[model samples]
Target: MKLLLTSGGIRNASIHKALLDLLGKPIEECAALCIPTAGYGHPMGSPEGAWRFVTGRRSICPMVELGWKSVGLLELTALPSIGAARWEPWVRGADALLVNGGDALYLAHWMRESGLAALLPSLEHTVWVGLSAGSMVMAPMVGEAFIETRPPITGEDRALGIVDFSIFPHLDHPGFDENTMACAEKWATEIGGLAYAIDDQTAIQVVDGEVQVISEGNWRCFAG
Candidate 1:
């Protein structure tokens, strides 16, 4: 599957262009599904937060309001009871998945439990547009510093490992003073693996196993 892992969604023209390139079509032609499962796991996550994400009221970027052909909700927590045969078709038919920010490990749990993780290997044509924790979930680990809620199955810091690195999102954002470059450096050292620290205007794109950093703002890569 194609990945567009973002710190704060498409905050700049470059990131938006990268997303378009991944979509391989105009936004109006693509069908998208917004996933809000991650938000529910976070301490700050609320019903209002999930609603904002689904309605694009958070204003991180176009996201759910991207003028797609259609936008649908994909609540991972509800999938287990519904059966894969019913929801699998919805995922396969969508051109992209817009995942929201929250607890990465929590998202990882549901992805596995809901059968999405197992199905990821076959979603070669689908693009995953991830915001914050959504992006972090693709990493091998998000590091202990980012853990809000410890996922029951995976280790405290470990994640989905779909990508070969870790991510420190919201780098240097004024609203999040803790997301400083120094903090990211500490996280990199603890991670002890390939990782990236990205600000709101940056994103990491991975397609066909090739990784590229797309940014209009600050970013840094730390090698293992």
Candidate 2:
């Protein structure tokens, strides 16, 4: 399986191009499965909010030009088994899994409850794409120092574990400071996994389980 962990959206020309190259298709020809805010459940969001977010009329514009089949597990409230089946097949048949940005803890919970965590690893054929919180949650620990909101973090810090190391997204971007980087490095040292401090414009792609750093900007990795 291939994993691409990115900062925000595919707005960066290099990031967008990398996604296209990895999927091995024209953007429109590929199907994308988005898992936004997985733990809190889709019912938590008012249908209107869910619609706007998925359609990308709000924060972090979604790359809809890349065929996005709305498999929003949270949005399907009061549904039957058939509904899950409907959602599953599109994702199962898709070329890639595109996890949208949201609260990292919530997204992780959703993955566990929605059975995506189990299913994803088994699907060796599909590419796993995570953006922002999506990328953050895939690591062993998401750097809470980088996230602005204080979501109710439960006792656990288990991320998707798609990558062996933990990552902090948007590091060194304009407003961020070296202090935050220090905090992240400290956290990684405590966790005993490598820490990748990534800039917003950068991307770390793992193909066949090997990670390749792809970006012009600089990033620092802490491992001990």
Candidate 3:
């Protein structure tokens, strides 16, 4: 499977190029399904704004500008329960899956309970694009440091384990809460495993088990 995990969304030409490369086709021919379930537990000024934030319209705008034909939002929470038959076709039909960031544990919970995790491995042709909590949920566990800002809703620490290493998103982002280099360092040390600290301009690209760091700003990896 191909994964483009970012702290923020695509913020530079190189990351955009990396996404295009993963798509293996012109943007106009690609279709993407944006999953915004992660943002449900987050604090927001208004429901509408929260919806917009979780939908990640700003992040998907670049793809639209590049001529991406179809980009739509999918809220897994709207479903009655865990069932692949209802959503599997939508996921399979999309060329890419864009996951937004919010509460990692919440996202992981829905992914597990909704059977999304089980369907992911079969989506060999779909590129997985993750932002913040979206990236974190793919790892074995999420960094505890984020609890300082947003508490966990699922009460579960373990993530999907789709990827071996953990990710610390928005590292050193002054405008965001619970996002500092020191927090990343502390979380990496606590996890006692490899963790990547990536900022808005950086991303980790994984393809067929091969990992590559794509960045336009700065990033660091902590080995614990």
Between candidates 1 and 2, the one scoring higher on lDDT is 1
Q: Write the per-residue lDDT of candidate 3 for residues 39-90, one digit (tens) a residue.
A: 7755542466446654444654232234567887677776446466877888
Per-model TM-score versus the true fold:
0.98, 0.77, 0.89
Q: What are the runs in model 1 whose C-alpha is more than 4 Å off?
A: 153-155
C-alpha displacement of 108 in model 3, angstroms? 0.4
Model 1 has a clash total of 0
Report lDDT (CA) for all predictions: 0.92, 0.65, 0.78
Instruction: Judging by lDDT against the true structure, name the best candidate.
Output: 1
Candidate 1 residues 101-215, lDDT tens each?
9999999999999999999989998999999999999998888887888878545677899999899999999878789999999989999999999999999999988999999
Q: Which stretches of candidate 2 lie over 4 Å from their true place?
A: 38-52, 58-62, 65-86, 143-154, 176-179
The global Cα lDDT (0 to 1) of model 3 is: 0.78
Ranking of models by TM-score: 1, 3, 2
The numbered model that scores best in TM-score is 1
